[model samples]
Target: MDQLKYQMVIQWSDEDDCFLVALPDFPGSYWRTHGDTYDEAFANGKEALESLILAYESMGDNLPIPKVASSV
Candidate 1:
């Protein structure tokens, strides 16, 4: 859901030749999914986040609290 404001870290990997997406809120793998372009990476990251939430719910695990950003 849009209400879940989890942090998504998108970075370009020269060696991999693609954009890597990582969900800091969710533990486990450093990189959940990736894409060839930034746009693709963003979309993939959203899908991955949804899947991760579903997986945690199905497994009866508590979802991690989303980190909030502070304004300067």
Candidate 2:
């Protein structure tokens, strides 16, 4: 299957002392993973994305539609 392009929001968290990652496609859930650096956060986010897709597939669940950015 073609890879789904999910939106990943990575931000620095003072409280957590690390870069936090959020998957908008799977809302309402807390941040799945974090990293000490931006690059690490990005890499972890990609891995999490793939794992999520595989999980939903194994459970026969439909994947959420990726949010598209609207040009203003």
Please name the candidate that would achieve the greatest lDDT relative to the true structure. Answer: 1
Tens-digit lDDT track of model 2 for 1-72? 346678999999999999999998885686988999999999999899889989999999998999989999
Give model 2 RMSD, 1 decimal: 1.5
In model 1, the runs with Cα more than 4 Å from the true position are none
Model 1 global lDDT (CA atoms, 0 to 1): 0.96
What C-alpha lDDT values do all the predictions have?
A: 0.96, 0.90
25-63, model 1: which lDDT tens digit per residue?
Answer: 888999999999999999999999999999999999999
The per-residue C-alpha lDDT of model 2 at residue 54 equals 90
The total of clashing pairs for model 2 equals 0
Q: What is the C-alpha RMSD of each candidate to the true structure, in Å?
A: 0.8, 1.5
Each prediction's number of clashing residue pairs: 0, 0
**Residue 50 error for model 2, in Å?**
0.4
Provide the TM-score for each candidate, comma-separated.
Answer: 0.95, 0.91
